[model samples]
Target: MSHLNVNFLGIPMASPVIGASGTVGFGLELADYVDLKKVGALSGKGLAPTPWMGNNGVRIAETTSGMLNCIGLENPGAPYFLEHYLPEVKKLPTIFIANMVGKSVEEYAECAAMLTVPGISALEVNISCPNVKVGGAAFGTNPKQAAAVTKAVKDASSLPVIVKLSPNVTDIVSIAKAVEDAGADAISLINTLLGISIDIRTRKPILGNITGGLSGPAIKPVALRMVWQVSKAVHIPVCGLGGVMTGTDVVEFMMAGASTVQVGTANLADPSAMGRIVNELDEWCDKNNVRDVNEIVGTLKA
Candidate 1:
């Protein structure tokens, strides 16, 4: 098997294949089905300064080539995660990343500070949350607001911060550059595209939140383009996700300049997606005569 090891923001990963946040549910949930050790890292569900029950009514809806989710960052809050979740997560051999989201800059900083535990390898700041301080626009949509959030979280946490940028922005490159300049250690792009689904019969929305973030193969192309663009504009490592369902998709993301790729919606369809992707990536590398996976990163011509 070809070597699939990757150094993601100074954290050693056995493979670049990771279980994306919101899909993996803290590494241990899928441990029974897939060998967690074989995977590179597990991005836990979005956590806030306080626990949330999530949005009421329909939380998920199916689409043509994707799915919409309005889970609303439902979790037991940061304190519970540090006390309970972190201990068990520590038992897993792979790297552990805590996905942090907040309603404001202070909450974001608080969450980041709380997640600075020994077992956690990194912090993935979900900039998709609304910036209550700046009306309702997402912190990631504006470069200044995004930088403010990044600076706040970076100041609070000793662990490397990976800011997850939203694809909803008008110009993703600007947001990526802003976060990078604000001291983000790494970047993860194409969080989810704003989408809507309505029931024709009842003349009503499908999701309780009326609008939800779309994921799956439908957004892969857009995600790829943004990852390629941002990777060129920034110096930090880029982690790519969106509609990744196969090993070939993993190869494509890496070729486009992603240091690593995350498995999101695919986990909902197939529990073994991450492990399968890791194996498939190794096979693809060997067949292509590539000895190291890192060689494929940013290898795109022109």
Candidate 2:
């Protein structure tokens, strides 16, 4: 098999495929089904400064090619994770990235600081959370707010920060550049697009939150476009994710300028998705005569 290793934000990964946050459940949950060493990295579910109950009603609903979720970033608070999950996570052979979520700039920074332990390789900051100080506007929808949150996290945590940008923005490049300029070590784009699904029989929204983030093959095209655009605009590495399911999808994202890609909903569909994707990616590289996966980054042609 061709070399599938990659360096993401200065951390060496066995493969370019990482388990997306909110799907992998702290990295160890898939231990029984997946050979953790074969996968690149595992991004734990999103964690806040305090525990979150998530949504009340239906938290998930299946769509045509994807699914909608309003899980509300549910997770045990950062303190609990550090005390309980981090110990076992440190023993894993692969890299571990902590996903941090917050309702305010301070909460984000606090969570970042709290998770800055010896085990974690980096912090993936989810700026999609509603900024309570700004009337519930998502922090990622505004370039300035995104930059502010990036700066705050940078100030609090010594770990490399990867700001996950929301796809609901008008100009994704602006938001990407803003975080890069504000000292973000890297950026992950196209966090699930905002969507809604309604139950025709009941005449009510399928998700308790009414609207939820959509993820699956349906959003792949939009994700590739944004990753290509942002990679061209910023010097920092772009981690592309939205509807990645197979090795071909991983290759497509990397060609469009993503240094790494995260597998989200695919994990929900298959417990061993990341490992299978890594194998497929290796096969693709070997068949294509590509020696290193890095050779394909930003290789997209006009």
Model 1 misplaced regions, further than 4 Å: none
Residue pairs in candidate 2 whose N, alpha carbon or C atoms collide under 3 angstroms: none
Candidate 2: stretches off by over 4 Å = none
lDDT digits (tens) for residues 1-302 of candidate 2: 43888888789888899999999998888998888888889989999999998889898999989999998888899999999989999998899999999999999999999999899999999999999999989999999999999999999989999999999988999999999999999999889999999889999998989999999999999999999999999999999998999999999999999999999999999998888998889999989999999999999996
> Looking at candidate 1, what is the lDDT of residue 138?
90
lDDT of 2: 0.93
Q: Which pairs in model 1 have colliding backbones?
A: 216-243
